[model samples]
Target: MRYFLKRFGFMALTVFAVCALTFFLMNAIPGGTAELILKHTFVGLEESATEEQLNQISSRYNLDDPLYIQFFRWVKAAVTGEGIGTSYVFRKPVLYLLALRLPATIQLAGASMAIAVLAGVSLGIYSALRENRISDHILRVATLFGVSMPCFWVALLLILVFSLKLKLVPVAGYGSLENLFLPAAALSLHSMAAVMRVTRTSMLETLGQEYIRFAKAKGLPLRKIISRHALKNAMLPVVTVIGFQMGNLLGGTIVIEKIFAWPGIGSLLVDSISARDLPVVQGCVLAIVSMFLLVNFLVDMLYTHLDPRIRYG
Candidate 1:
């Protein structure tokens, strides 16, 4: 209970800090909040809007209040579930926009994470079993290549090969599974590489353990020894890597989303940033942070199950 409480408290604090920083930074930018809101609200309105109109709009939105007061007001409303506020660009509730886009983001993240975990763990196990052989060496080189490649470059190259030349997938825009392959593959590459490397290292270390030798000497079949003993024991580090990669994939999907037009929260975040839509930006950040925290919390629980020594207390 104490450990969980402490972690939950930290997550709350992190969320508050992110919200404050996001709000302050958004306001501190060159454009005025009132002007941006009014301009976006009324299509034809521009910098030339009269002072009287500005005051009215500011007063209506409580934007004319002192900075600290505005912050507190927004925070209170947000915490109480009244809402963070409307988008400065879309003139709609920020949550509404997020709700619409969240599923698409979930789809991409899920697909990419599935790919990373499945292929990464498989490759890692194979490499460890073959330790120092030609296949292992080749796998290591591929892992290095994945880790070194920039995401955008990977995305572009995949598009060129699969979408443009091979006609195997769509270059951009989202709809069906065919539309998702190139982007998900691009997004999973780095994570898959990280997982593969970690798993290989962890599995190798576990396989080298004295207990592994005992299991082998006890007349256990090679398959049973590897599966029931080696892989199970080796999973702790791999779990940690997967947990971290899951959070990263959720946030990092922004680039892939933008490139593929996947309409995920990451793409929404980028659009909100470009438009200076602070509410939307804040909402997106809050959502991402919440997701990451949730994943870590689950991973923490998983630790106790994976390793009996990891007690909550």
Candidate 2:
């Protein structure tokens, strides 16, 4: 309980710092949503609109306030559950935009991580078991390629080979299992490579331990010895990597999401930035930071379960 509480306190502090930084950075930008809106709205009517009309519009949006005051008002609305107001570009509520896009992003991130964990662990185990063999050599080379490949290039290659050439999967858009495979594969490749290396190294170290040798000396079957003794210990490091990679997967889905035209938070973020929509950008950044922190907390809790040495205070 003490450990959990301490971590929770730290998380709260981290979140407040992130929020403050985000607010200040957004304000520090050259212009704001109000300025953009005013430019577009008063394009031809600059002479017709009286000073009162301009002041009314600016006051209505609270654009006339100081930067600190504006930030505090936004913070108040966010905490009070009063919605983050409409986007200056889209003219829709920020909360509404998030509600529509967040699920897709979550789904993409979850599927990518799941695939990376399963495939990477399996291959890593196989390579470790067959160390110095042809299979290990092949896997090592493949993992190197994966690690070296840029995600955007991988995404484009997959699009060309799978979507364009083979016509095996849909080229773009979200929804349906068929549409998910390429993007998920692209997202998982680099993570899978890291997992493979971690698993192989851990397994090699675990297999050389005295306990493993003793298990083998008991005339236990190779499968039983490896599964019951070696694999479990080897998995500790792999679990740690997976936990860290899950956070990366969430943040790094931007390229894959954009390539596939998936309606995820990454795509929304890109669009918001292009349109200079401050509220939407702030909300998206906050959501991502919160999710990443939550994931790390869960991963820490999981460590205690996965390894007996990781006891909570």
lDDT of all predictions? 0.88, 0.84
Which stretches of model 2 miss by more than 4 angstroms? 38-57
Per-residue lDDT of 1-313 in model 1, one digit per residue for the tens?
8877888899899999988998888788997777766676677876588898889877877777787898898899898999888876777898899899999988888899899999999999999999999999999999999889987889999999887899987789888989988888998999999999999999999999999999988999989998899887898999998889987788679988998888989999998887767789999989888888788788778888888888987
- Model 2 scores worst on lDDT over the 10 consecutive residues at 32-41
Estimate the TM-score of every prediction: 0.94, 0.90
Per-candidate total of colliding backbone pairs: 0, 0
Cα lDDT tens digits for candidate 2, 18-51: 8778877866778645555555555675336566
Clash count (model 1, backbone only):
0
Worst 10 residues of 1 by lDDT: 32-41
Error of 1 at 257 (Å): 0.9
Candidate 1 residue spans exceeding 4 A from truth: 38-49
Clashing pairs in 2: none
247: Cα error in model 1, Å: 3.3
